[model samples]
Target: MSHVRVAIPKKGFERFEKYNPENLKSFEQLIEEQNGDTYCLKLNMHLLRMYNAYPQLVNLKITRLILLKALSKLPYQHFNFARKYLIWSQLIDDGIRVIIDMADLLENEDYEEFWMHYKQKATILPILDGFDEAIRKYICFKVGSTRTTVPCMEFKMKLAVDKEVLMKYITQLGWMINGNEVKVFPLMLNDSNDRDVIRGIICSDIR
Candidate 1:
């Protein structure tokens, strides 16, 4: 079954939050605000684990070196920077992957290598926009396809898979993957005027 999904803006909200302290009343207030913001959700798993294992360590260090290496291979090199930050800060590696994938799709023009990664599930769907029209055409052309890599958003076309096949692959590295029953709220990235914001929801599982 498709699982529940939610998308938030690639709003660079975190960067703004980090740099724009004056936007809020106090630094503590800023932190509290982001706790509910989608951009800051990646801290949940580590935060939860910290309370149990070592409450003394306010900052957890993950040192996910392998994941960091993977991030460097993406089209947009900025992901390598983001990935390094996550590893250094002990944030989820999958979150790093998702961010890199999304950034590559949004900023980079190359897709051939990117497609190869998605084919292997080494990368998740990136935050992309500007291909809704192409998506419609791909859906019409491909049938019974497990996944399709198109110019727009990347999609996994699971037409007749049962719950058993579904269960095995439901877990996403950064976000949670659900079955056909999953409901995703679209985050609109494109408008007639401004450049399309990066589309795609941030799956809670991944965050």
Candidate 2:
């Protein structure tokens, strides 16, 4: 898997902690080390909190991944061009069909075939505008039609507990935000073999 660095806001951290405390820092510290000027974009602490609290609905990581993949092969200066043309173009096309709408078209047996094909292609996680919708529908189908446990909801509930505990821990640990906004910057992961380092860094809390 190609790893891309992402910067999340303080509020986003709070939300992540609120949702699932277990290994919560596993992803948080990864975002913190990023230079704020490059990646934070226009997001604020308030919006970060809101997005984190209900990530299944408001998250845009898929889009982020898509843009990153297309630009990763280009020079850094070309990112703006890629974002304007390739990313937005792909987003428009994907959004129109919408994954939720397409989910109804597949039979139970078709999912396995589709899953296998996508996984083999390594395109299973590609950028799809309605990815959340598609994932929800697929999970529902996978667990059998009669099952009522919503995976998204279950995730949120677990996340909420974790988030709450993380917040308390961070506060006690003095990892509070100092302002309304923070700048974010990009950090390149030069090698693919450093999974252990990546995992360790993310799992650590910022002091």
Candidate 3:
């Protein structure tokens, strides 16, 4: 795996692989990966609260593993180049495809497989784009029609929660553009790694 060259911060991954998940620092890095800039997408804190509140979704760590994927369509406007962990989906399926896929991946605490899947820089964007479309379609047909005040009303109702409490948190992180204009276009390539922010300080001797 060392020679495989994962896109993650090498030193931080070393700690993650070595230290206990219960160890505060290792746990913090995991938390960072969930909500931090390592990946362009982030978890919806509100959806996470919902997942936590439901016993069926409890104890699976599904919130941590799947919530970010649920919100993968969001944009990340940072400039770090070494690690292009942009998670976008282009697929057109409803939600079933991704939900089943995510469930299979997390079924047995398959962290290594998940890590390997995410370390790729090439496919994250397309996968996210696909997942985004899937979510919209699934929420519409299987859950509710887009004509409703809330598109995914049926899906939310399945959770047995009030629409008010199921407050959404996705639009907060999307691209912002007024009049579809751009004021600046900075052009420069950076070879530096975003590992420090993502995985914390890197150690010269990770061994």
Q: What is the TM-score of each candidate against the true structure?
A: 0.22, 0.21, 0.21
* Per-residue accuracy of model 1 over 184-207 as CA lDDT, tens digit each: 232222342211221111232235
Please give the clash total of every predicted structure, in order. 16, 22, 9
What does candidate 3's lDDT look like per residue over 37-114, in tens digits? 334322122223233334233323333234345333222212121112212221222233343344344333343453
Candidate order (TM-score): 1, 2, 3
| lDDT of all predictions | 0.32, 0.34, 0.32
What is the RMSD of candidate 2? Answer: 21.2
- Model 1 residue 137 lDDT score: 27
The residue-level lDDT of candidate 3 at 67 comes to 39
Ranking by lDDT: 2, 1, 3
Q: Where does candidate 2 stray beyond 4 Å?
A: 1-9, 12-88, 92-109, 123-207
Number of the top-ranking candidate, with lDDT as the measure: 2
lDDT of each residue in 26-97, candidate 2, tens digit only: 343343333323343222222233334444433344334433332222222222422332222344444322
Better of 1 and 2 by TM-score: 1
